[model samples]
Target: MRVTTTHQLYTARLPNGGAAVMDVRSGRGQWQHLNSTAALLWNQVIEGADLSKAANRLTATLAAQGAEEAVVRADLAALVSHLRALGLLAASPAPAPDPAPMHVREVLPAHTRLSLPDRAAGLLALATALFLLRCTPIRAAIAAARLVARLPLRPAAPERADQLFAAVRRVRSAWPGRAACLEESLACSFAAALRGRAVTWVIGARTAPAGAHAWNETHGNQVIGQDPEDRIWPYAPALRVRHGRNK
Candidate 1:
């Protein structure tokens, strides 16, 4: 089987110039540390290097140490097998494509306030999302959002998307515990889905800081709830949950 690196992988640059990757799908939130050689190999594979070619190149680098080609190849193969078992490699469909260039930066929507009832509902939705995140796997929490969107309710307008996001963001602000971008975005999606708004939940990774982020967007690619000052331009979209039939 032809397996590619998982889209959920996020790189984190170490102070010592090394890098580590995290597979968010693992649900364990542990980083797989990589030395310089391993990091180079990973980047090469991500950029389309096959195992044979990668092993050959790496082995050549270790020629001074008299590393045998056969041994290096065997080690590389074992590493790949282990990574596949860790959900960091798969023979699966391609992930979400990069967003449209023109719309990418300007897609973020203007925020608006929701009614008191709606705000309360948003908080309830956030609580449910938090509980799911803590008790179930990440995939399960996302699946729950997908299920909620399938309910028989009127589709929410674009304006409602903005209001719901505002409500969710407000609710999160008052919580004593801090929520990561992943959780916050999921909560917003959960609240919107309950109100019949099918939004896109996106998770992306960027290199400089070597981190991952999550956010919500609408059919038109209009982003919701993220601050205009916080630039997501550096991120490459890794996964997307497209819920609505609309564009």
Candidate 2:
């Protein structure tokens, strides 16, 4: 029963000898304060102490501070339960296993013929997406791109998943140097949506060095523009960008 803080949360100790916690994800600057006992418990749990270890430590500390032994034990128990309910405690997630031999070479787009209009729009979108990702914060860039992608556009009839993938890869080739996997994936997704095809944006992770990666998957779970090595990244996604229809 080790404890851990949730995402986008900030914790700090105050001059008044208490702890303050704020939730960044809510976009509301609300804060919660913890008293001495709660703060101590929070620290112990955060430092990787198990439930039994934390409770025993707190019990001894409070008892020596002139608190009654029975009362200290009961109060600690109640505090642990309360914090757990508030999502401040949980079992640790299992780790990713060692990766097998993987071959992750970059794929070049097919030299498929395209109409002038389709080629122009995809290239333009690719340029805009690349600039945005390089210059702006990632969350804001994704939000802005998604908004544009969802806008109404009378594009050519929906293309098959593989054809759409090839078209996307072609647009991606114009991007200078090596772009982040996120940039490539989102650009492809945005372009596909413009062409009236739906592709899912996937974010995955690798554990040993703790890196995050991104790519696209079709509705049928086929990956676009990414190799099988990418498919076996081993860690779960930290984020996913879904289109309006999926929402």
Off by over 4 Å in 2: 1-109, 148-159, 228-232, 245-247
Q: What lDDT tens digits, residue by residue, belong to model 2 across residues 158-230?
A: 2444454455567677656665566667766666666665556655544343445666655434455656554
Candidate 2 residue-wise lDDT at 124: 62
Per-candidate Cα RMSD to the true structure, in Å, reads 7.2, 12.8
State TM-scores per candidate. 0.63, 0.49
Each prediction's whole-model lDDT (CA): 0.63, 0.55
* Superposition TM-score, candidate 1 onto the true structure: 0.63
> Which pairs of residues collide in candidate 1?
219-247
Best-performing candidate as measured by lDDT: 1
Model 1, 1-247: lDDT tens digits are 2222334554544434444565557473445665665666666666567866886787787665787777777777777777678766553223235444313422224355468866876798789878888877675665565565455545455667668777777788788997767777787777876666666776655555566677777756766666757764545455566663211
